[model samples]
Target: MSAVIRLLLRRLGISVIVLIGVSMLIFAIARVIPGDPARIALGPNAKAEQIASLRAQMHLDESLPVQYGHFLADLSRGDLGISLYTNRPVTKDIAQFLPATLELVFCAGIIMIMLGLPLGILAARYRGRWPDHLIRVLSLVTVSAPGFVWAVILMLLFAFYLPLFPIAGRLNDSFDIARVTGFLTIDTLLAGDFAAFTDALHHLVLPAIALSLSGIGQAARLTRANMVETYNKPYIEMAQAYGFFPSRIARIYAFKPSLIPSLTIIGLDFAAMLGNAFLVEAVFAWPGLSRYGVAVILRKDLNAIMGTVLIIAITFLIVNIIVDLLIAFLNPRIRHSARGSA
Candidate 1:
């Protein structure tokens, strides 16, 4: 087999192993936590027989190994079991909630790329100028503050004071656009509801920006550092000596090379938004999987918790795989070296 194919296969294998490990760890942790899922579901007022019956129905009475076996078997068949709190299939609950989180994360990722990359390139092009210093300071400030803090600050400034954007939620209650794909923006567009789409976009702005601030800072910093290093490279110097404009050199010669190194970390930052967005979601009262995740954990709903964790893990793995493939494609050295070895 070609080295690239072998490398991809290896990465796939590692992703599977990592997912399995995450599942096992989460399962073990959920079980070890000091609370009976059945009892929690039943509540303090429920009788012993009720709790016992629920336990029996849930197969919580089984031995840990047997329970784990059943869990794996059910997972193999795309069953995530029933949620104790929601009293619905875990997968169903995830389906209902996950899209909101995905929408928010996707928006934030766009903001990160749009704002971060250009700033980085600009900063690198300017080097030690005032604009570069200003970008560096702003990035530092954003990176130092937690996301929730930004959420609050942004909400106060834009939502409360100026009132430019809606303070909370995915959409205003008046808009009854049909849910085609569960993504409000796309669904609204598909429905030809430009008004609803505009409202949805307006509502998404603050929260997406809040959730993306840290990622933007990190992306900018990483991109700037890498591009600065690239500016010193022989090829960049050659391009400059050949009478190419500094702007052209920075945009073409320096930017693309620097981007390859920055892409992996940028991918990771985007994946991390799934977790870090919880506080932002809570602040905005955005109905997403992060809110559902918090509810299940608080209620000690084992199946829901496990399902949420597993989905997040799967997403992280998928992002990493995409990043790896992109890196392999962008960096010819990897492919050439692999071919040489083969």
Candidate 2:
């Protein structure tokens, strides 16, 4: 077995364990909550008989063990049960809104990587200089602020005052592209609508930037610290002694090693955006899973909440697994050791 194969198997085992643990925890939390899903679904005015019927329908009247067994059975068949609030299949509700959240998260990640890595490199290359101090201060300030704060500030300045980007939503109402993918950028391009594509990018820009701000700061700070430490390593000193070009050494040698640590932090931030998207999406009126989560939670919609939490947990696990793989690839020790017979 190759090292890559071994690493992949190990990651798969970890992922399964995580999934089981998360499912159990979320299932327990959803069940133990005080509110009755049946009542919430039927509404405040529902009659006693109506509530009893709904409880039976939802299996809330079943023994706890039986209910859990039913849930697991449904899960095995890819059903997440019905939403108490919407009276729709939980899977269908997630299908409707999940793509938007994924799109937002994806755009935010791109913005973070594009801005963070380069800024970190620049800061490290000019350590102790005015530029380094400036980036450090800027990163600290931005990293300390939550994504919602940045979203509101951007809305007020760029949306209300300056009127640069549209205040909210995914795309302009005038564009006539089909919503096959639910991603306006892709849908517009597929329809050969360059005009609509440009409009979509314009809409995506502000929110993406807002989501990326803290991630960028985190990446830069992590990169700067790692690169600065790498800069003092004996290998770096030897490279300098060998008359290697400063720029070349920094870009090639130091950059790769520093990036390994940065990758971990970046992946964590990217995963966190799924949860953080709530306020940002709400403020922008972007219909995404996070908004759905908030609404479902407030309504005490058990099935909906379970579906949302499970999806988010799965996404987080996937992200961490990818990060682990990347780290293993970049770190020679792990890659080499993974293949050894045990």
Candidate 3:
């Protein structure tokens, strides 16, 4: 009955409706693409009878509406059907590669947050100074460059020229960690192999940093702008008058409030990295969903494409929802509504 609860329910309802609409759109678009899923599956040298049988198996013989209905029904049961390219269950294929992408994204996110926020705060606090100008220029350059550009430059500098890191892939041949979770870092730790975990971390470092650079720049700029505004507020002035340490006032009063807006946008950028991860993966030859997505799209694999698109959409939606919830918690208007009901 609380306003906070009501708001949450409303957001959840909207998200569900949006997801349904997205799925329907994806399903329609996939079918409408100018390609024969059956023929693609059977390859270029398929016999007539084989193509016919494959089409029948894929239910390409069914009417469009009927096929869409079947797709929706299967989706309700957590099945995205089968991939024509891999000839595996769509969900299984996604599961196989999704974790790798997720791992990269996760590490990238951590790097972005660890580096971006402090830099932003520092730049904002030091506004009109050399440090601020330097950070602004750096953030501008970083934001302008694409992830793939960073990936290549990083590879050329670190892998080829300096030979500081491995050129491609998730792990070295020497690692003997069990693939329990399919995440090399976690699997190595689970196997109690510190050496392998260290090696995996080293492999992950460059790619994660490359993926995160743009996000870090964007976050820094957003945070810096917001924090600059927040620093000029009456509360900030009052805190300064009260002899509050500049550091404490900047962090506790200015930075925290400014972060609400920055976090929301940053969450969206992080979600976007899921799609961008493809370029990074391709450059590194990492076996992530991004590479899988590119491959399946080229092959015109409808089910695989659908599954990948749907997953990315859901990830984006989920990130937005989390951002909303975080903002609601931080903003007194929403939090007080919940507190009042309690």
Candidate 4:
């Protein structure tokens, strides 16, 4: 096999193992938490016989080992079981909710890359100057505060006071666009409703910015640090000695190498947004999986919780794998070494 193929296979195997471990851990943790899921599902007014029957039907009466075996068997068949909270298939609920979260995270990722990278490059290019000092201070301020704080602050300024954007929700109540992709922006565009698309984009701005602020700060700081170190490298010095323009040297010789390191942690930050976005989503009242996750957890809905966790884990792993492949592509040393071995 080619080196890239072998590397991908290795990552795939590792991802599978990590996912299995996470599944087992989440399953055990969910079960260990106090309260009977069946009782919670049925509510306080439910009769004893009803609770008992529901418990038996859910296999809650089975031994933990047997229950785990059943879970594995169901998983093999791509069954996530029925959600007690939603009274629908876990897969069905996930299908409904996951896309909203994905869309939010996607917009946040764009904000991170677009805002963070330029700030980093600028800061690095102007190290020890007033601009660098200003950027550093600004990044410090952003990194110190959490996402929810940013969400609330941004909402207050832009949504409540200025009222430039919608204060809450993914779309206005007026537009009734068809849900072709479950992503408001895409679906609106697909339907050729330019007006709805504009509204959706406006709604997305505050939440995506709130979700991305911390990531942007971290990415800028890391990129700045890495690029500063790169500046002292022999090639950079040679580029400077050869009388290349400072901008050219910074852009061509320094940025790419510095970016490789920054990309790994930035990728992690992007993936973590999937989880950290819950608070932002709650604040904005976005109808995403984070809201569903909160509902399931409060009720101790086992199947729903497990399915949500597994899907998030899968997303995290996929992001990591993509980062790894990108790193390998960017760094000639890894690529050449892999090719030699192949």
Candidate 5:
């Protein structure tokens, strides 16, 4: 228990340090981008005096270190400055949009685990049989392309020709679901609108599938490869000799051991989905943070860009921490080893 607490504290402290690096890196990148943000925000007809004023307001005339000092000071107060794109505070803009992306990514992560693991297990169980071959081929095909390409393909097939799923958006406009959580499905459920919840889910399916396809494929391949290797180990051969059910051995003995390493890659893929969600969101018209981030970056909204990227960085670190805790939990030796080293 103490080891777990220590691990959490250590990870949190490391996350903070990483976030500071991320802030400085993003700040430098934003600063170096060609073109004055003030000119871009004000547009072509802006007077020189107006541009100077805006730059001053942005602290652009100050030295980089001093500008960064003020930026950090504002950040400490939870002030992300104003978004030139939305004319709102960046934090408010993120609050409005972040949950949608999180919901979408969460749904995709679920798909990856639920679908990928089983397929992998089945493939490993079958070895060189047709099921294994089929799954391998399918995974290869799915992973060959990026999420947005899948989004376009799936949208065209199901949304246009077959019309099984709606083409885009989080919910039908006819359903007046409250924006309680910014996650339409949860919000609708909270509102006791089963009909709206179903509609929201209906809208979520295509985009989630689009975002998850690559991850699903990657997970399936990794799980199958690892489990296959696990099967050849001495314990697996002993389990086979002991008359243990092949199914039981495969599920319990093989899968559990292989899962530790798989968890790290899977977690990374899950985090990667946040970045990948941008194109899929654009395709689906999903009004997520990804869309807002793209908008701010194009407009050179430095404050908004930094805020969005920082939020994403924090989310990424949080996911990694969760994966670490999960790994530590699953294998108690991690805790023991930490306590040992400490």
Candidate 6:
């Protein structure tokens, strides 16, 4: 098999193992935690027969292994059980809120790549100069504060004081667009409603920037550090001796070699941003999975909590796998080494 195929299979195998382990751990924790889930979900007035039936459906009478098997079975069918907090299926609730969270994260990731990386490259290109110093200082300031703090600051400056953007919610309530895929941005565009799309994007700007600021700082710093090191390599010296344009060397030679390490961290940052979205979402009054997750945890909604945690865990694994594949594609050494091992 080709190295790429082998690498993909290897990552897939590892991700499966990790996901199974996470499921087992989360399943065990959800079960052992203090309250009777079925009773809680059903309510105090629920009949004894109802509670028994619910427990049976959850495989509560079975052994731990059997219960786990049933959990996996239900998961395979996207059945996460009824959520006590929402009085809806956990799966259904996630479907409603998850897209908003994903859209926010996706925009943040774009900001990280488009803004952060180029700033890092610029800083490295003009090391010891004013631009480098300015960018470095800005990055430190950005990273010093958490996402929620940034969210509040952004809301104050852009939404309240300056009144440049909306302070809360995904869109102006006036635009009555149907939820085709639950993503307002795409749904509006699909409906060919430019006004709603513009409004949705405007509302998204502050939250996405708030969430991405820290990631951007990290990406910038890591890229600068990596590229600075890359600059010292003999290859870079050779490129300089050849009288290659500074921009060309920075773009082609230094950046690509340094990107592998930076990409790994970016993947981690992107995954972590999802968890970090809780406070930012709260600050923005954004309706997303993070908000739902907090609600579920506060109520000690067992199935909802497990379902949310499991979904986040799965997202992490998937992002990591994609990053690994990207890294393997970028660095031939990895693919060759994997092929050799195989």
**Which candidate's lDDT is highest?**
5
lDDT of each: 0.92, 0.87, 0.87, 0.93, 0.94, 0.91
Q: Report the number of clashing residue pairs per model.
A: 0, 0, 0, 0, 0, 0
Off by over 4 Å in 4: none
Candidate rank order under lDDT: 5, 4, 1, 6, 3, 2
lDDT of 5 by residue, 72-138 (tens): 9999899999998888999999999999999999999999999999898888989899999999999
lDDT of 6 by residue, 248-325 (tens): 999989999999999999999999999888889999999999889998877778778888988888889888989988
TM-score against native, each model: 0.96, 0.95, 0.95, 0.97, 0.97, 0.93
lDDT of 3 by residue, 229-267 (tens): 998899999999999998898777999899888988899
Q: Write the per-residue lDDT of candidate 4 for residues 1-342, one digit (tens) a residue.
A: 266677889999999999989989998999999999999999899999999999998899998889888899999999999999999999999999998899999999999999888898889999999989999999999999989899999999999999999999998899999988899999999999999999999999999999999999998899899999999999998998899999887776899999898899999999999998999999999999999999999999999999999999999999999999998888887777745544
90: Cα error in model 4, Å: 1.0
**Which pairs clash in the backbone of model 5?**
none
Instruction: Select the stronger candidate by TM-score from 3 and 6.
Output: 3
In model 6, the clashing pairs are none
List, residue by residue over 15-134, the lDDT tens digit for candidate 2: 888887887787788778898877877878999999998888778888877887888899999999888777799999998899888889899998888888888988998999998999
* Model 2 TM-score, all chains together: 0.95
Candidate 6 — what's its lDDT?
A: 0.91
Error of 3 at 54 (Å): 1.8
